[model samples]
Target: MRILQLHVDFVEYLPVKKEIDDAEPLLKNEKELIEDTVVILTSIENGDDETLIEDFVKETLDYLKKIKCNSVLIYPYAHLSSSLEAPKSAFKLMTQLEDALRASTDTIVVRRAPFGWTKELGIKVKGHPLSENSRAIVKKNTERQPGTLVEVVSSKSDAIDNEGSVSSALAAEKDLKSNWYVLTVEGALIPYDGYKFKKSEINLENLFKYEILRKRTVEDQPPHVKLMRKLGLADYEPASDSGNMRFYPKGRLIKSLLEQFVTKKVSQYGGLEVETPIMYDSHHPSMESYFNRFPARQYNIKSDQKDLFLRFAACFGQFLMTKDFQISYKNLPLKLYELTRYSFRREKSGELVGLRRLRAFSMPDCHAFCQDINQAKIEFLKRLDLSVSVMEEIGITPEKDLEMAIRFTKEFYTNNKEFVQNLVSKIGKPVLVEMWDDRFFYFVLKWEFNFLDNSGKASALATDQIDIENGERYGITFIDESGNKKNPIILHNSPSGAIERVIFALLEKSAKMMKEGKTPYLPLWLMNTQVRIIPVRDEFIPKCAELLDQLKTNSIRADIDDREDTLSKKIREAETEWIHYTVIIGEKEVATNSISVRDRLKKSSYSTSIDELVKLIKEPMKGKPDLPINLPEYLSKRPRIAS
Candidate 1:
């Protein structure tokens, strides 16, 4: 059983609908309000029985006494656990638990929200640290043997995270202390507070505040969330778990292009692309230890009495694969890349926003195995350049759209100060520095490029980590020149982070432009419809089709606006879709064998030949993937997916 306990000023709930066939009949389906109560949002999980009732009551009474509250309300909430008990059994247990709580203390009043009913909930929890807490109540095993398998769920909200297993690194990270600095291009580490900011350094300063203070909980949805839906990119999937999204056709096309581009860049950087499984055995020796090494809540599953877990990164599979291969130092600096279609991380419900953070996302992960630290350093810089180039080609420039942050232990900085300074000099800007007193994670040095949104939240994009562990942990060995087997140092690099986050950054950047009273636009290559060809008259429909054919021949995504609407309205709709160029076909254009084109970005219109229009559109698309339009060629045939 899992429970999220909240001490609220008042909890107001109304039964809106019955979610289960065995839903309890309510005396009154009106709003039920409880004041000055300890509300326990409960999820009854498998294997829970009367054995847990005593402990549950004891915990509840202790909490009430601690808070000096005499009132309690039990609310059945299903989202707290993926593994749920049967509805009938769960309802009975919930009622029995409530009865036990009431029978325990004469001075306390106990109430329960109707079970198995869909209800509208309103809660105002107090702002104290003890006001919110979660717990997983399991049947205690007194007769457990040595070396027996035991499943333990965590209770840390800010550290190890959630009910699932958390990494030891993440838990240590919570208590890790660091001194902040701004590393300049001239190789001086100025204290963060001592460094003065320039007008152009606003984003960097925002990144400092976001990282140093570590305020990641988002209060309101960012501007990109609305724009994502308004532009037909993606939306939250209500049918699935929170933080999982459904992408429309246009969004799919954009994601495909980005995945293709990032893969191509990695391949050119000597990475050998490979595929890996989405799930692994949690009881496996390597997985068991590695779980606490990297911090994230995982989705656990039970199959045939064996414990399994969904992967949050491509590291496990890739490392296991490399461990089985016979390699030598000649093959050192071996790079393996995988573009994971879906990596699962059970993020906190409160932090699950649009595409910025997700439970499942596509990640372009690449790992390089090196002979030693020197080789690792060389490969790290190469991957950094590759990441920078990839971002630049994707229209997100490092100097303008991103801020650099490098984190390391004090020992690393003291030993390799010049190497760290070179990284800042390479980016040609002052970077945020976090120098830890001790090493906690597998990586001794790490850096990432962050994009600051309008709400001052920093989202990491391109990143690389110089990991000194995991090789030996996974038992991967490469024969050295002296014929001795040695573990290789691994480097983890994600050139563009999650594909969904790239889209979020693009949308956020456009929203930022709109906020500045500038025209908002997507990169031409990413636009679903690069050009829209509209017919001025019914006779011009045939002419517009011919022009579209020409545009298609040159690999331009052009669509015909053949609907029976005024030419002005058609053009306005095209503008709303952010079509780069709108071509209108009419008598003047037909007679002269030319087209009247409206450029959305330039806000200019002029007559140009079909060849010139093709060249104009194709110029900026140089070296980029040429994908056909995702929607139909005629606008009239396309369904409205976005508002």
Candidate 2:
């Protein structure tokens, strides 16, 4: 079955004549109009039978919910498919689809056009990002030719074909035997299905549905997609691969600051920063072994008759480097850190949406080589704190903005129950726990903080893993005090999962605020233009420039709206741009040497001296990295990058 779904403002159709002998009886020959309806132009192809009714209805209902409309028009359009079902059979399935849809939802109004008829159709589709979609629904075929493409039914309403090489761990991830539980801070292990949730534990429940249940309803692009483009942060790069993004100047500035901040934080915690090549030889023994151990797809390249693949994480490079080092128990816990500028992961195409998930991303990967499990546990806690602190500094509060999930081998949890409980206690909440019967990957234990977005989807943010096999697998060893060389335990930590994902979380958070009738603004420290200076008249442009100079001298990012627009329009533009403070200069301000300021966050206007405004902006930015404005200081000189 094939369908073209559309959200239309109004659709009109007229049954002129019957195109087939099995056409349905028409009650009216006049034109019919339905306003604000979901139009599904469906085609029932050969082999499409009664089995498709349930899925078709469910997909229609999901689409209705996403578009916030209750009316649906299921039109039987034969042009959608080349090989159509027999007219009599197609009519029966079409009506069955209509009946199933109406029975599934009480509020939904389902309507259908006459099957096997030539009709004049008119539709004015909605202009939003998710107004139109195409889907192909087909039955499973167990047998196929050698070169045939594999078609996988998407978890969402649509269908997608699987591509790229699947790693052993990635395949194991789909079939990993696990028991799910909710581990409370008080050390109670409640079955995930039986645990009672509090009203405040909505995000926890969402994490359960995302991880254990594997349920996703919102198929359209997330709220952050629109916000990313509107706010001029980032956008899809059509010239590149699906998951690669083109960051605007503001986006680059934000990315740069986050990189600096995270690197500084890791260094403060005793991590020796290092650099590594972004690509590695695919035929290398260690690379080939490690690829199957990790659950990620690689971007393969052929260079000079040698096969090379992009690195998905810093672990391989750091592990290979450490394998060559000579160390003793005296240097038990050696930490190496790298802020990978472009870690490449060939994520499923359907999963590529804005900055939430990207093919190329910056990851702050830190590895700690430990002598034993005991040492690894202690370092893990410290790094967990570091993760929490880093996210908090980035304006994503843990336990509020993030939900904790801990995955471990059942044997590890059995021997180290207190250690596992300590982690939940540190989070101060009941966390989702997945315990496997056996270790499928190198990590014996791993925990991550996930941000549940406005949609029901959850994305992992800060994560760390305690790898018990990687050191031995890579031949990285340390000599103990007893003079025996042994493989050291490796702990992989990404304090901030990926810099691009952090921006996505911030934008998604802002979208939530907007939905709740609040003035959404970025963190003051991350704003590209901390303060926007607007001259009320052309004569006051010099005064605005002086104010900009003063702000620059104080290390505050300030830009002048020196365009020829009216004062109100300039102020509105500043607010739309999410500028933290808008300082309006005119005769009154020039006469008094004070400025009128509009704080976008506060949504109020006040008068303050330039020194006072500078101090106000600087206070919140004390510990954050500062960078000059990435765009032109004057508004007139700037190009319109975002619509």
Candidate 3:
């Protein structure tokens, strides 16, 4: 399976509001046109009144319909501090706006915000009496006390001692400085005095300054900044090493191991490994459509009066390759894999973090074409098995270290809930299903393989999907035994999304495990430097060199540590690099023609001969290691495997 990094612009519909005393004249005036259109609303507040809110919303819907927009997304700006107290009229306006839009036009689609945003907005409204019957259920649930209310008990005469009496009487106070009570009704401790009652008045300014409002407002800033930061575009650093040699020696070793793993595993699965140009003609019909669909992710290049775009996915190239060859039923289940890098877009400036989201990164992309529906299912399952096997080799166990697929509900197509439900049902159970608001209708099944971090949060490591739309769009077809051609079912599956991302996950996971005094278990074969031959003394240097030579002959990733450092320090360094085995050459072992071997995790030593050590390492190396690694043999020898 090939991995991919796609930049997507999360388009949202925002309801705009403009208050005009003369509604009829404003509608006829072109200057008022700016106010009526829904071009991404900003600075929405809770306390906005009814008529102005309704008029703005109605005009925005009309403008959206006029523009022929298929989807109208209600993007909540509640993350902004200004949106804290959206006028009640805004809610009432939206209640009638949907039906009003439906009455006017059937073309435009509408949808609510993502659950994450919805949940956040709900939290903001907690303990708010004005927000008591708020549609946001999360906010209502968090309300401190629904029936209990707070009232202000203003000071009258200086001798009254109102502060002491109020504190003792009320369950809670809105503000201690300004006389306010948790209980709106007067109690025994603080009787309702005519002077204090007369002084108290319910006004918008005081209501907004309420303690609950202040607390919620203050708490909202950090999380909003964090979310915004996460949505920013990724940043790229120039390659420091010349000719891709900028990588540290250890990093190079790791890269080599990953390449080896991918070559062997993908080749074994009958996947035709290929490479394609990173840039493509922007005018190409397929690419043009893709750009329109995900503008934020695709990069455009101008040359010779023409536009070119960085290829966001390898599937298009693979599909284009298939057009050159005529295939029959016998040649069914064709799988194509490529290790390529492409540029993807990001919406926020701070979203980019290390290798997780990058403008350019390498992915192992596999596109499979099958003649029959069952064949497609079988291929997907096989891909899933391979993905799991690879991750396991790298010490990622499905049930323990990793959680494969998580399914959750998301608001689907705005206007066509039934269509979305029908589509989801037909696609079958996704490995990890979450209700996604921004997904295409044509793709049925979508599954993502996730790796749990130290915090137990799942990060997507790989993805698999069945695309029925792209097949028709790209005109990919196969000829059957009856000589009839039909559009082939296409499966876009990536076992490892990006090499940089997988490396990041491995680094984080390994570092955490080591900090906890745990040795990271890696499949013997995928280890960057499989064996580290450490000479106990200068006398054993020759023996170590000889052992290293023997290992190299057997294609074992072995190295010699001839550093002047102590054996213990050398061993510690080797362990830090996560080398699989450490072979220590001491006087006794050299004399006996055996070396003391220490496993990275065990940290316990045992004696083994040169031949025996090679044999031992060879066993695990015979099969594919879990994770994406490159085996030298596969690269040097392009085995003519059938797909």
| Number of the top-ranking candidate, with TM-score as the measure | 1
The 0-to-1 C-alpha lDDT of every candidate, in the order given, reads: 0.87, 0.85, 0.50
How do the residues 1-643 of candidate 2 rate in per-residue lDDT, one tens digit apiece? 8886878788898888889888888888899989989889888989888777777887788888988999999999886567899888888888889888888989989899998888887766664545666677766553353422222222221111011122234334434577999999899999999999999998899889988778767757788899889989899999999999999999999999999999999999999999999999977888766644542267879999998889998988899999899999899799999999899988778778889899999999999999999999999999999999999999999969999999999899999999998898999989999899887767999999999998878999999999988898999999999999999999999998899999999999999899999988789888899999998889999988988998999989999988888888988888889988999998889888899999888789999998789889889898888789999999899999986
Model 3 TM? 0.58
Please give the distance, in angstroms, between residue 84's alpha carbon in candidate 3 and its true position after superposition.
25
Query: Candidate 1: deviation at residue 289, Å?
Result: 0.7
Lowest lDDT 10-mer window, candidate 3?
Answer: 1-10
Query: The CA-based lDDT of model 2 is what?
Result: 0.85
Q: Assess the local accuracy of residue 536 in candidate 1 as a C-alpha lDDT between 0 and 100.
A: 88
Residue 220 lDDT in model 1? 73
Best by lDDT: 1
Residue 48: error of model 2 in Å? Answer: 28
Ranking by TM-score: 1, 2, 3
Regions of model 2 farther than 4 Å from truth:
1-175, 294-296
Which regions of candidate 3 deviate over 4 angstroms? Answer: 1-246, 342-349, 406-432, 435-439, 480-484, 521-523, 624-643
Candidate 1 local lDDT, residue 347? 80
